[model samples]
Target: MMLDDLSARPASVGLVAGWSFPATVFDPLVRQLPGDEVVAFDWSTFSSDWLGRGQEERAVPGLGPAVWVGWSLGGSLLLEAVRRGRIRPARLVLIQATPRFLAEDGWPGVSLGDWQGLRRAAGRQPVAAAAAFRRRFDLPNEPAPSAQLAATEGLDWLARLDLRSQLVSIEVPVDIWLAPDDPLVPVDWPKHLELPAHVHVHRFEQGGHAEWLDHAASLARSLVRPLADDPGARSAR
Candidate 1:
């Protein structure tokens, strides 16, 4: 976990990165965010205790009700945390995220064979497997060397966890950003799930899975707009 104090401004932003990639991969996007403080959580270190840790024991300290953002697998973790009453944020942003990653009876997602293949490869050769995974998504940065174990755990969670039924019950405001061209997450999957009235979905025409890499500035503006408009809004701590 890394915290960047951008300014003395009161607002803070917490970020969780996806599988295979390190938290530093969010540097570009974090630089563009308007928050005074930014906390980036690394999968390798944070995944182990994500659900077990208490609220005050979270990576972010004195981070009262900030805008929390998660991408890909990280988004699933965030959803799980919220569902379990782990962390509450003023707003939640999910990028290229889906409630479930593996294809179900009627859902569109990664095939079982492909998911299993990746899991096996990661078990045998994590570094090479992660490299191939990053190449497949055209991820911009290389993950830290210790991400091997975390990668396997992430795949397991992706295959086993499903949050479609939990979406409607979350009390926080959620903004889900989707890319129509994203190969990993199907844009049409949301149609199969029921979301709450506070949940809003936005689609971008370009930028595949790593939209933040291609459109960081635009995403930053969109992320801060609501906070800028409503400076007084605070989530339950």
Candidate 2:
């Protein structure tokens, strides 16, 4: 799916990071999107303090009618927010994310035992496990301490939360980025989902789960270009 229409950019772009990845990691991507208002929903902070604290806790200031770009667990969280009417975005950009984290409905996902084992390891050796997990994704930066704060709960949420139906119900334009070789979330997962007609998908031949880190420039372009065709964005401009 190509976003060929180019014009004005969105009024705001919300960058949502994956679990354990801080908003700062997206600085490079942000730099690529100049002249557009941008806000980031820090995964570390959200996980640590706002997991199940209720609607008020999930509120992000100045975050409406923008293109919401979410990666991994961040994408699921964003969908949940939309499901609960917490935020309404003009468009959605999901990277290496799936509606369900745990295997269900014949879809590929992490098994409960493996998910629990990782959580246990994180519990036993928080820092080490954190570093190791990042490295596994080819991300060298150290995750924020807040990420580790909700490690156990975060894993539980991943293991149980399912948003397949929510994804299909969304009507706004959407883009999904995938790495075919992703070990966690399968590349074909999105194809199985009965998403809306506006949903477009792009798969990278080579990249780790954190594809944004390596394809920052390409992703930045893909994300910003679509805004030009967004009716709401054109009206905002």
User: Model 1: how far is 126 from its true place, Å?
Assistant: 0.4
**What would the per-residue lDDT of candidate 2 be over residues 32-129, giving only the tens digit for each residue?**
66534777766655444344556553455455547788888888777777676666677778878888988766788877777777798777776666
Best-fitting candidate, measured by TM-score?
1
Off by over 4 Å in 2: 1-7, 47-65, 142-150, 227-237
Q: Per-residue lDDT for 61-133 in model 1, tens only?
A: 3444477788898888888877776676878888889989999799999999999999999988887788787
Error of 1 at 208 (Å): 1.4
Candidate no. 1 TM-score: 0.83
CA RMSD, predictions in order = 5.8, 6.1
Evaluate residue 32 in candidate 2 and report its C-alpha lDDT on the 0 to 100 scale: 66
